[model samples]
Target: MPDAKPAPAQALSAPQKALLKLGLTRDIDLALHLPLRYEDETRLVRLSDARDGQTVQVEGTVTHQEITLRPRRQLLVTLDDGSDTCTLRFFSFYPSHQKALAVGARVRVRGEVRGGFMGRTMMHPAFHAAGGELPDALTPVYPTSAQLPQAYLRKVVASGLARADLSETIPPELLGSLQRVVHGTWTLRDALRYLHHPGPDVSLDALEDRSHPAWQRLKAEELLAQQLSQLTAKRERDALRAPVLRTAPGGLHEQLLAVLPFALTGAQRRVGEEIARDLARPVPMHRLLQGDVGSGKTVVAALAAAIAIDS
Candidate 1:
């Protein structure tokens, strides 16, 4: 048998692993790489009971199904999950995948419930192999895009959860200290992986019923890294940006502004004076500009350009 396994993606990292429970996260492996808020999937309700706009599990035989191509090469599949049928739209479908979705099959659909005309229960269904009744609730939905199919996205997350080589960014002693301080149990890496793919869905008690110690660690580390990066960037700017030392008596500055074709406004006059003073000082000039919706900051900038043009 050929390797049905998909190809490799970006290696999982600490920050990514922490984001698993977030609905099909914007980042795929981030939840597994960082850490997580424990997730609960035991909270599933039947499709019949799922309300409009709520995520409901449709577990039924897919009796009637149809596929049609609309204008501009679009593919649409309408499916029924017993409660009611809804259109399952797929923008890009390969020849093989379409053949697999034909009618007369048992399938599960987890999708958002929507209201339809004539008070019919409808869903934007995601097809899957039908299974037994769900015993739990609060299924974590994921983010999806056209480039990545929801099925492929689900598989990648499942793969990341299955990986045992999950690295812990939080230190042991720090973890222990966190457990003692926060009065919680699980380490950082364990929390994130277990949330999306726990061996056994267990009840936890602590912050948000979470015993994962990695939340604080992950947040603190990421924040510190960002702060340090900012600080380093500021230091680099300090070294690289040279002060204008243009502090000569205001004679040359006045002469340059005098050459402008149009007369200057009071605001422009004030700004020019400020820039001239800032340049004369030993300190570097790093000015932020504010312009109204049509304030013409460009015109103001042009006046400064005249100085260089004159020089």
Candidate 2:
């Protein structure tokens, strides 16, 4: 049988382009847009049972909203779930915000509870309009700008994933090697899927800690790519010839060490020996010496310089 033809890429909608400020023009780009955080909407808490300082999610109707002045200009909103009433105060707000929280509109909000002048308050909560059935999975919250709505971005991402037709970017042999090393089982696509929309069965703790197998798989691939890049560059550099300097025994390096008032730490001595070895080698040295302040790196560098000069 003839192999099925590949699907053509879809152009981003005007709204989607605007929402994705990072210019995620390709399907792979959208796939790589990792969530900044996850919102678990499997269960909703009653406003009345919510405690101060706890971060919780609640569904409620906007009972009232009014612009107030005196203590300071602010927007006050009253939200009532069947269980209890809470205030949603906005010190920084605009007319559009007020319009969104019109009376009787149902919304889901997640925020840290703080005691306020108007009883229980959630000052600057992350919110979304609600009415449809609650999801049994974690909702990815992407990095967003003021102009971009979360819902709009979510829609764009969903569309991208559905139509992406993404081919495997990582070679199967390399993936297998990585899996053998880490005991991870997720594929690249699976990792992206789980990260963007984790099912209820997935451990929330692991997701938050970024220790989930899927996350680990993706992170490992990224690290492997970086390591491969470095190794390739090193190989290329090693191919080039460098001047070899064979220093005489009891050279200037030994003379400088004899005159120094302070003793060198073991670490300093080790680094000096390594640098001297590099200087003697025919290949150019590409070593990075990093140490905390007052670690005597300067002294080691000076010693290396003496070896270079004496040779």
User: Which candidate's lDDT is highest?
Assistant: 2
- lDDT digits (tens) for residues 1-311 of candidate 2: 99999898898666666755677777777777788888777778887777889888998899999989959998988888889888888999878878789998888888887877768888888777987888978888997776667887787787787677656667877768777665667777777887889986777788878888888888887887799999999999999898886656799888899899999989998888888899889999999999999999899988888878887
Error of 1 at 91 (Å): 12
Q: Cα lDDT of all candidates, in order?
A: 0.55, 0.83
- Which runs of model 1 end up more than 4 angstroms from their true locations? 1-55, 61-107, 111-124, 132-147, 157-227, 241-244, 256-274, 281-284, 293-311
Model 1 compared with the native: what TM-score? 0.47
Candidate 1, 223-253: lDDT as tens digits: 6569989899777766665545442345455
TM-score of each: 0.47, 0.72
List clashing residue pairs in candidate 2: none
Each prediction's RMSD to truth = 10.2, 7.5
